[model samples]
Target: MEEYQKLSLIDPQRVANLPTPDKLFLFLSCTGSIEYPGTERAVRIVGEKLGIEFIESVDQTCCTGYMLTCNAVNPQLALASTSRNLSIPQEMGLDVGVFCNGCYGYLRELAHLLHSNPAFKEVGDKANQALGREKFHGHTKIYHVQELWFRQLEKLTSLVKRPLTGLKIAAHYGCHYLANKDVAIDDAQYPTFHEEIYKALGATPVVYKERRACCGYSVGRGFTHREETVLPHITNKMLSAATAGVQLMTTTCPGCNTALDREQKTITARGNAVSIPVIDLSQLIAFALGAPVEQLGFKANTTPVLPVLERFIK
Candidate 1:
């Protein structure tokens, strides 16, 4: 078994380029789009608030990481396929921003491989040549939306109309975002982005054990491990959050949300109950930015967060 490497992503001091780029191509994810729609809505709403030019391509296809992780496809095939998918926006010279952690990791890792390995680049080149699209010149920059928000924390702070006031939130940093610690996202050991956002919105951030533990949906769902190993880990997370008195929980990955939110009943069935609502970091941002709760799609949630609504909703 490959040991999960512990990592911490440092908070970026500034937006890579301020005043926002004119255009950003979004590589939306399946889990985020359908299971945690509020995250998508939050990204759109935050982009609007920041005056960012955002573009979406329905013609674009999946990164296929989900299937790849399940060993359903060859790694080489996954690399070549991702290279083709990434080339779409590079041809348009648009910087890429993804809301999903899986997309962020797959796209960045695949792009890095294509850029550094001549053999891999050749495979990607031949594959794209067959498609007749321009070669992916490696001109594109990839960013997770958290980078944008952290860079523009001041702007985010100014937009808060309904301060979170005394509401305690626990930050759930999924494994993928900081998997490569040298990349340094937001202090993985004492992550501040999610907590900072909660603080800026006027909520208190809570810390607890296993704050960095895997949400257990990564490679366990397809196997019985989800019932045996995964559920226990998730149960621990819930107990920690519940005991800490956190009113809400937030994460950047949809897989984490799906595991924590959709599996709440299973966790409860194991003789553990979690009262705090699980939400995406994006959903919390949308609320702070004054978006209507109904528009944010809370109904899609298996775990109702309605009680916390009165705190943020005007």
Candidate 2:
């Protein structure tokens, strides 16, 4: 058995088949870029530190998976757009690294459909016919940035200068990453890789009751059902985290970051005292790895992360 395989019997898929690529086509997330630009900046710093080069292309566009998730766009259009965006990385002969769970899950599923389903392959063919030069052959593998971090945990730990020695951090895996259980890197129901990463950084990983619950923002629930369902759902999740004494929270998805970070104000307004600062897992990793705080872009976060930073970041 491989060394990584021996680490976990439950989620061997996480480390057994994990790719440690030196170069990747970094798929930019619309939410991450617009809402938390620090995610990209932090990812770049981590990549540089880890000796991985992140490549970006202007030809790539939004994955269009969000629209499909919201039931707002035609399936054909979403597939075509995904195919087009994927083709850019395939042509460059590089796999994709996505920072958002939504992008990772959506691209992975759509690409699977294109490769496995003849009906979806037909749609991909039509999309290729429409595009003059590029073609998506479903050759590019999509990975969440957190998986990459796990793959390089040893090296990442070695590079940590600002260790989170006394902080209590919780992981929000988000729903999309494991929606397709067959392709997931960790156990869908009870993942511990995030906690493992926390340990690597010397931080105490807090386990809360609602750790596996959905962020309530997926599929447009935050917008369509904020008052009735979303607020209460997130309130419960936050209350559980707060009870667990989670001083900081990390997410693999920017949309979830937006929901967890921004909704705390609303939760406080509704008489819940939950205010755990939420950030991208990549940003936290970069912070621990000694990346400058100014580049991490905490300014855009709705819930101020300064208090959490002061706890560990010197």
Candidate 3:
């Protein structure tokens, strides 16, 4: 149950007790940027509050991870594209910090594979060559921003703009991010930093039955099995959280947000779903940090943020 026990997903060299870089390249996943703009805006706002500078890239595109996992594309193609994205951070001389759980998982997994396996690295390198880009060398370390925030609990607590004293917040850590135990904020089996994140901002973290359950977005369940698989799975998750009196659920993955927040309408129409609102962890942090309500872009949420915002937004 220690770093040594977990498969070495994070670069061992980067594992020593080193100060987290104040400036990091924030890799905005496709969903986090366009589909759910609040995540990007809120991340920027929260970064400002933490006094951390975020560097972005116009050349960067989707992590191409969704397809990679779904087997729509070969690992070579996935690795090649991921290399180009990682290169942007490497050239800037900073580690990559991702907000989306999907991006974090794909980028980290791709980087680790390329770094440790010469054959995979060669495939990625050739793919990069075809695009007239530098070969995939896996030079930069990848991290989820949540990991940074998790380590700064005291700092976050010190900067609370509006305490969510009576709020019942549920922590949806999602699946992929935690699967990589070596890199996640805490034990993937029983993550606590998320609950801690909620508590630090003065909200009560709800402990629900499916707190550790998969949102069923990954592994092609969404497309291959929605009603038969994804819907029922997610519905049960919602059932437990709502039954526990959850007001809003916070997630690290946009995919999970789509499954848990958007699908509630479907479940509700069928007469058996909870209308619990879902938002990215960053938006919640931005809210607690007093980022302007308009800036957080809660209106983008499928489930109304007003249910929770009305409590604090004034």
Candidate 4:
């Protein structure tokens, strides 16, 4: 089989492009909007601190990604729909910055398809032709804001008014970010985006067995596999955090948030004692950036970061 063929059916280009100056079209995933609204708040605050302009688009729809994952939507329709969705950001002439891992994965997948798949490209081209407007040139770069933060590591470190120096955290890099080998993100074997970010913010990153395990968000939660597969998978991740004395666990996926956060209580109810906080990456970033604790959405969390908040205040 060919190398690209070995990647997931969807592939995202890992190429780097120049940064553009315009209002960044922030793409919101369904889970991110309602469940983790604080994450949206964090992204905006961080962007403001960095002087990065951004705009949110309500015209965009759900990446409809969950449907595509469960074999509900065909690739052709998914691809075209995603192309239209991405065009919203392109209108701003700025590269899109995605906070949700699912949106990142889906947008990146389509970007790769437009570049590599003639069929997808043709469909998109036809649609653009019909509108007689600019088509997706596939020039826009897709990024997880975490990547931008990584680029500004030194500046971020300087601006960290409240460093999480002694806070032990487990960084969860959700699967969608690196399932495809071609778009292979940061050594999938031992990805470290979250860990590196934690370290830069002055915290220790804990590596655990469930570091790479699926959160069972889309499937396990929707189905009756919570106890059998979901719990075990989540338990493995949390137990590692607990054993390592990690005070908190962070995730980039809302679905992962759903699994890790909501399930933490269930784990405790089962006689397993855990004191760790499950937080979104944005929450952690916001916390590090010295945003007020209330703004970080700690209140919405199941495994609250109150202790962590107490430390920041002190």
Answer with 3 or 4, whichever has the higher TM-score: 3
Looking at candidate 3, what is the lDDT of residue 172?
88
Query: Over the stretch 7-38, how does candidate 3's per-residue lDDT look in tens digits?
Result: 32333243344245679898888877775898
TM-scores, one per candidate: 0.91, 0.93, 0.90, 0.86
Q: Write down the lDDT of every candidate, Cα atoms only.
A: 0.77, 0.84, 0.78, 0.72
On residues 90-175, what C-alpha lDDT tens digit does candidate 1 reach at each position? 87778898887888888888888888888888888888899896677665788888777777778889998778888878888887
In model 1, how many backbone clashes occur?
8
Sort every candidate by TM-score, greatest first. Answer: 2, 1, 3, 4
Which parts of model 4 are misplaced by more than 4 Å?
A: 1-23, 125-134, 180-185, 222-226
Model 3: runs farther than 4 Å from truth? 1-18, 130-132, 219-225
Pairs with backbone N, CA or C atoms under 3 Å apart (clashes), candidate 1: 9-184, 9-185, 9-186, 9-187, 10-184, 10-185, 10-186, 164-201
Off by over 4 Å in 2: 1-10, 219-221
Question: What would the per-residue lDDT of candidate 4 be over residues 61-100, giving only the tens digit for each residue?
Answer: 7775765676544676666667777777777776788888
Which TM-score value belongs to model 4?
Answer: 0.86
Q: What's the lDDT of the predicted structure labeled candidate 3? A: 0.78
On TM-score, the candidate that comes out on top is 2
Measured by lDDT, the strongest candidate is 2
- Enumerate clash totals for all models, in the order shown: 8, 0, 0, 0
Q: Write the per-residue lDDT of candidate 2 for residues 184-302, one digit (tens) a residue.
A: 77778777889889889998888888888888786345457546678888999999888888899999899899988988888899898777999999999999988888899999998
- How many backbone clashes are present in model 3? 0
